[model samples]
Target: MPEPLQIGVVVFPKVTQLDLTGPVQVFSSVPGARVHLIWKRIEPVPSDSVLVLTPTITFADCPQLDVICVPGGGGSDDMVNDEEMLDFLRRQAGAAKYITSVCTGSLVLGAAGLLQGYRATTHWSAMDHLAPFGAIPAKTRVCVDRNRVTGGGVTAGIDFALTLVSLLIDRQTAEAIQLRLEYNPAPPFNAGSPDTAPPEILAFMKERIAPFRQRRSEAIGRAAARLG
Candidate 1:
């Protein structure tokens, strides 16, 4: 029998659970795919959405991965500067087939100094931080730059994972899985992005995340310097 496809996702405190879970669900559905939630500690980690997930393996024990994903959320602010986690990710990516992230998770990948010179995307709010890491930030929902794959925002993990299915397995398999999951998306409102939202709403939304943006900018600056 062929070896199972090994996938590892970094699970940390205060992750935006959807960013991790969405892709994980997709990956788990694929035949011969083994997904591992990895962390330095094996304890349960909390998310902003009231979900607590346990890690499947510690950093030292994780096998060489086919994919290494980082999911971002409120906790990413702290993770952006976590030297231990950054070092772990850096070492893992050295052997992984693909290096990836979702939403603010890209910021964490950036901290690990992984996205440099890659075309990548993150949650719109955190996109600007990519430049400091030598990343060529794209404005799309999903991007594949060489072996570096990235998805934007929380929900984009699904599409990104499906994209991975095509790359790792085959288009036929990915399509079948998408159909099995009924992956059609039809948002009720046309207000998902700044260009689609009204002026006042965009202003308000930007204001709401100003603090996070400022903090990310500062943290990424420091992380980028480490790569220098």
Candidate 2:
């Protein structure tokens, strides 16, 4: 039998814990699949004030991967402005057979100049930033264009990873994994998307996240200027 496909997942300080753990759970379920938590260095990284995870491989230690996935959250604003990290993402993603992102990770990819002319999606609040990077912002929870794949906000990572499993392996396997996890979602709230969200809720969220949005916007502008 052929060897299991090797995958690398990049994790950094302040990445949403769910973004990393969700995909890890799905991809690891695939038969003969191996996933490594790759990082700029081999050390414990903290996410949110409570969660800290140790890396399985460092930049110099990672093996070439069939897939490389990056998950993002609050750290995205900083990452988009980081030359070293953006360059590393560009180099690693350029060589991977499939490069994927969850949530604001798409912004990092865009900042790295990998998403130019690609169709991608990111957290809805930050979707507008895609224009500077020359990517068409997709409204879907998951968007795949050639080797690049991106997902919407936090919860969408699970769905996106399941879709990837189906693409790489088979639909049956994906369904089985979903079934095992009871992936049938039941949300008490009806407003998941911008179009469906109540005006007040949307306004509140937008207002609350304004500072972060501004930082990311500024970062994207700088990245675009550099690329230009």
Candidate 3:
């Protein structure tokens, strides 16, 4: 029999749980696919939300993965400037069949130089930051360029995973998994994006994240310089 498809997700402290969990659920549903949560160490990592995640393998022990995904949150601020994390991703990208990210995790992939010249997407607020890293920012829910796939914000992870599943397996299988998961989304409020949200609500959110965005931009500057 063929070996199972190996997939790895990099889990770090302060990750937005949904960004990781949503994709994991989709990836896990694939038959004959092994999904591994990886980190610097095999320890519980706290998330931006209440849920905590534990890594199944450390970076040192992870096998070459068919797909390597990074999920973003507050933790990504530090990750963008983390040489060790960036180094690990760089090494993995050399052989990983696909390199991907969800939410701000695309920023981490950008920092690792994996996204240079790739068209990618991230949370709306951070989309502009991609250009500094030489990434063409695509403002879509899911963006796929060559072997790099990225999802916008948190909820888009499921869409990203399903797209990946279609590529890795088949559309019929992806549809089956989607049906099994009851993935039809009919959100009560159509305010998920800045374009759809109320003007005041969008302003409020932009204001709320301004401080973090500033810090993240600064870190990205440093990471970009390092890449140069």
Candidate 4:
């Protein structure tokens, strides 16, 4: 039998837990599908201050992937600036049959120049930076451009993964997975996007993320200089 479709999920220190776990749960649920938690090293990596996940493979040991998914969070700002990480993303992206990202993962793709001339979406907070890499920033829940797929925000990872499964397998399979999860969402809050968020919620989120934005700006600056 042919090798099962291998999907690789890259993890790093301080990665948002949902970004990795959400997709892992979805893809792993599929029969005949394999998912690998990969990292720069084999040592367990911490997610925020609470969780540690042992990666299945390290950068030096990972097998070639059919689908590569990059998750996003605070760690993404650092990964976007790392020469090794950017180089790996550049190469893996070129060779993978499908390349996908969620939230700020699009930022990593942008840093590698993969999003140039593509219409992409990302966590709204970081969407502005796409233009620097020549991408047309989209304001949607998910955006698909040929072999590239990107999702918006943290929760969008689940939707992105399901969409990918639909793309890879079929809509029936995707709907079945969603049904199994009972994924009927109904949040008490009416606002998930910046435009729909209340003035106070938007203000609070911006203020909280200001430092991260500044650091990301500086890091991307350096990465751009190096790329030049």
Best by TM-score: 3
List of clashing residue pairs for candidate 2: none
Per-residue lDDT of model 3, residues 5-112, tens digit only: 999999999999999999999999999999999999988999998898999999999999999999999999999999889999999999999999999999999999
Model 4 RMSD in angstroms: 1.3
Over 1-228, each residue of candidate 4 has an lDDT whose tens digit, in order, gives 878988999898888888878888899877798889988888889986588989998877777888988899888888888877777777788778888899988888888888888999998888888888778998988899988899888899999999999998899999999999888899899888888899999999899989989998887787666556
TM match of model 2 to true structure: 0.95
Off by over 4 Å in 1: none
lDDT of 4 at 82: 80
CA lDDT scores, all candidates in order:
0.90, 0.87, 0.95, 0.86
Q: Report the error of model 2 at residue 14, Å.
A: 1.2
Where model 3 places Cα greater than 4 Å from the true spot, the runs are none
Against the true structure, what is each candidate's TM-score?
A: 0.97, 0.95, 0.99, 0.96
Candidate 1: C-alpha lDDT: 0.90
lDDT of candidate 2 over 1-228, digit per residue (tens): 997798888888899989889999999898998899988888899986598989998877777788988898888777888887777777777678888999989988888888899999999888888888889999999999998989898899999999899889899999999999999999999899889999999999889988878887787788788877
Query: Sorted by TM-score, highest first, which candidate order results?
Result: 3, 1, 4, 2
lDDT order of candidates, best first? 3, 1, 2, 4
